[model samples]
Target chain A: MTRITRDQLLARLRQEIPETTPWEVADWLRDGKEITLIDIREHEEWVQGHVPGARHVSRGFLELQIEMVQPDREAPIVLYCAGGVRSLLAAHNLQELGYTNVYSMAGGFSAWINAGFEFEEPRFLTPAQRERYARHLIMPDIGEAGQIKLLDSKVLLIGAGGLGSPAALYLAAAGVGTLGIVDFDRVDRTNLQRQILHSESEIGELKVESAIRRLHDLNSDIEIKGHPVALSSENALDILREYDIVLNGSDNFPTRYLVNDACHMLGIPLVDASIFMFEGQVTVYQPANPAKGIEGGPCYRCLYPDPPPPGEVPSCAEAGVFGVLPGIIGAIQAVEAIKLIVGIGEPLVGRLLMYDALDQSFRTLNVQRDPNCPLCGDNPTVTELIDYEQFCGLPPRS
Target chain B: MSTIYIPTPLRRLTNKQSRVQVEAATVREALQALDEAFPGIGERLLDANGEVKRFINVFVNDDNIHTLQGLDTPLNPNDKISIVPAMAGGTVKA
Candidate 1:
């Protein structure tokens, strides 16, 4: 028996499977048709460049992961590789597995690149940025493109206390383009334990000022905007409007509810985290109609219809918290924010994650949109930001 | 018999017992069993109409009870139930 050469195998597979051109696929994508494009290249090849919105299932795991990528066998499937040979073979295999609408791109990703078709490639990184984010640029999950998204994205943090401290540091070091920090408090000796952005030397300095200094020291290439005023109904929307996403690390219920309402009104994604004692919770509330592929989900109000009655929940000062708790939860918030900006992987939208440091366990729960929610519900009542301090039974900011 | 997993926030009502075993064929009955075992725990989970509270999510195995059959969803002895509450506070330090 004679063994078939690679060319002969490619010819055989091409005869059995339909072939799509790079231009045609690009056109189909632009037309907004529901199609699933799978990249059958190695991890390194995919990290270099590939078509946007293409599901990556390397040739080695093509069969094993195809079901997870495209559950519907009838969905239009297009497979591509570095050249076209591997995709042709992979397309044939998919067809053998009962996939009806499978096609192999004739010239694969190389053809797409050569034709100048709309494809996603890691952005060109400066030598300094490359060095700073060496670990990030190498990871298949967050390559040059993700890092670029981080550098180009704008994030607003509501506080510079415990939760905000770690979130701001990681986000700044990650090279987020513009970091807008809103805080009016001064660093105190009590904050030294967990507020990593401030040090003992800066005890009396403004929280946002100290934060800006620390973040600048970490990554001077990024821009830092400090809002020294309190976030109120009058200025929350205007201040939050400029940022792509918001991270609510505010230490009070008034600010938490205000940030949620403002982000909801402005249609900005929010990464919310709260810590009390050894337990912490982190979740993302994306805009109503999340980016394509993400499920449309509920906002913070949908989870807790209204803020807990004043004093119903104790503050960290009343009930001491583990110093490292915010560090863990804030890091998760940073991860969720980056995922939302880069439009990659499954975000925590509509899901709440609860962490208990005492028991060392994490529980995730599904959050559903309530048609009766006061803010994001169909019968929506809270149309604009209200006086959150009054709403939370706190004296109005003088 | 099914095992119900309680979340941290509601653990105070359950005597800090993370897992509780009960015998019930449906989710509603399971909640009733949980209430009997740990008094007043079901009140936090169910409203006056006996419907699961809007802020609470109950999952049978990996499927949310709302997507299944709500309180009527049938359960097997080997199935695991998880009850989670919506987290809503960040003022850990005043």
Candidate 2:
């Protein structure tokens, strides 16, 4: 019943970020402010062409590897993605983690390249890289500052198939600080149709290995960290705690819930994207308070009180999704994550936007909080983590 | 006297009947009458606390009952009731 207008809400939220200007960020980047520019995009985009000197650590891996990227808590950091939503989420998360002086590039690379600044040609590739990335260097939205955002970013990907493919490719070509992959699953024959991260020779090989090789072949300047382990409860929180933000591409509900809960508990924002067939959805859940706004605002539990019953809802395993679905959804997820990291644009919160590719219909629903919600209710009952599988009634992993 | 429509999944609890007539001053009373005539239907329709489960969609006439007044939404004689699960499309691929 307490509804604040958009302007009023934003005004309240503005206190979370330290006010800075683009010229100031430019000075920090040039003046050796020890600034870290993060490109929160996937690897594939990085390969196509990226900002020179950017790291490739993904938002998912950023939480775990944030210290590695910026050991100095107060180091100046700038973040950017394709359209600039994810970086904003990232900047908010960084602020919550007690890191000051984090900035998000306004309008992201889309605006950077549109500014018509010079871009670094895709490096460490065949003579064809010039032709492949010829269109990138000529654009203004991905000019030098956007490229710097890419060069200084490090993105780690979870799940190199489907959604991760485009995300990885885009981030790689964008020139991130470092690129990391955490996936033990092998590239299967079925993956070729959508997993642009691996090729025919990569089938049956570890996904991280395949993704790293392709990403390196695309851009050698970015570092690639390959963790060949399935993210589980024992390791999920520990792994996610270090990174700045998390982008979830896993198809299973358990992983999704685990990531959500872990992010909230650790006070990290998660850029979530899901695709069902041709339909896709994307949102930024700032598990931390909205900077200057309400504390414990709305977590995933606020949207979904309880996990759906097993076998009651279909997964990509049971439900075949369209090949292009992840391409659309993952790219958007990358975009949002970068926006979050960089501090630009309004992040999607307290709303569920569902896309129906069949009819090309996008529906936005106002997700209200359940006053009796166990996690975020007026009087919460869930204070600690319970085995999500048990709560969801799934068989415990042996 | 309003007609109560049973969804396909719950029809087994109602002996495969598609519709039935019930008398009540409101939706809640009519649901209580249906539970009296049939058995175990209310358990699935209503949670343990008697509130409608979050996933089930109940409509009075053509309007969602939640938009009206939830379980307290009034019902009149000759009102039509339909119950449907929020079943989305798609089958698992793997």
Candidate 3:
């Protein structure tokens, strides 16, 4: 095999890939030229800052992803790397892929920076984060940008029990920046049957405290806030207002109603789920965001305007829940919460997903926002959080 | 005839049948048929004025009856009807 010097190789590639200067590329950007400018540098180098409005398709993935970046083979596309050598070779490779108008930015990002051209500095993933969320980083939808969003997001869990256990664990593992757990109950031996977040050693310990220890052990990269108090109308708003989205895993009609009402008023998206003997249901109640043209999805009240009378619907304890039911439902709740935080995928908004564990079937049913809903409807009532216990026909707690 | 999905709480009334086949032309008729097949379903499904209970939702296929035509919504020959109720059983204390 004949060996060639690096300079000779670059010279040969330069003859094939057209070279454009930083000034020319900057003008193209300023003049709003329809050009696809890509930064073909490594993620670490790209994070230090690169050309603004430039898409990062690293050299390693350039050949595989350029078509997805710019499907039009004849369209003007510019590629740049640290010192222009890598991008020159990458442009040659794109030309081989039949990209007719691929150009390498002459002298690359260093030249652009030296020439006083402005570049954008993005919050890059740390080495540990890149390793922790390696799967997510590789995904097209939840790439580095989406992972960063997850790391900066805060989600609150209504209960650190069955549903909250899995939801919190996954959220922490997924790198959701902050997690707030609201549970005043103590972990009990019975809870270990399905509440995987607690163990026998955690028994008699506050659920929130046990949950924090478990979640922190899972991922120290995230923040876990433990609100060891039962959520009521008084403190619901204050506690809930801190988080971007919420997961409703609390049992009993009082807590359900309280979380829904608070979330609706605060305009926070709530991923709600419930499990019975062999069935579990999950849905998202997103408040009306007129700016996003989201005329609000259905609230809990829209689906169930009133709660059932006490003893009418038995609790999980009375009905004996199929232990793993909440695992599926709560994991789904985590997925919805992650979607809400990352601002990707179609969430469970306006759709109720029912899982029949016995039949192993999932059915998605459409749920619409009620035009006459007392809380979220046009003619609204119940503006303030009410005593959910009394509202649900339960005696006030002492 | 339409297939109706009976929720967990109402399974006992439907003889532990998760999916029930009923002969009905409309959602209201379906509920009435469900009650006829299973004695107390109508009383549980409807309020005193015979309206679908507020806490419960009835869907013809994937769409809610309120979005369709309430109880008057016509049922297709092989449509699926789902009766969903607000269940609050997130954690077990017993």
Which 10-residue span in candidate 1 chain A carries the lowest summed lDDT? A305-314
Best by lDDT: 3
DockQ of each: 0.19, 0.14, 0.53
Give the lDDT of residue A360 in candidate 1.
Answer: 90
Q: What lDDT tens digits, residue by residue, belong to model 3 across residues A1-398?
A: 88999989988988877999999999999999999999999988987998999999989998898778899999999999988898899888888889999899989999999999888998878888899899999999999989999999999999888898889989999999999999889988889999999999988999988888888889999999999997888899999999999999989888888899999888999999998888999999999889878767889999999998777777787778888988999999999999888878999989999999988999999999898999988899989988887888878877
Assess the local accuracy of residue A325 in candidate 1 as a C-alpha lDDT between 0 and 100.
91
lDDT value, residue A31 of candidate 1? 97
Give TM-scores of chain A for all candidates.
0.69, 0.61, 0.73
Model 1 stretches with alpha carbons more than 4 Å out? A1-124, A289-295, A390-398, B9-15, B24-75, B78-81, B86-94
Instruction: Give each model's clash number.
Output: 4, 109, 0
TM-score of chain A of 2: 0.61
Candidate 1: which docking quality band? incorrect
Per-residue lDDT tens digits for candidate 2, residues B9-82, read: 46567996767899987788888999999977887778789887765656787555655787888888899876
Off by over 4 Å in 2: A1-150, A290-297, A369-371, A377-379, B1-94
Return the TM-score for candidate 3, rounded to 2 decimals. Answer: 0.77
Each model's C-alpha lDDT? 0.84, 0.68, 0.90
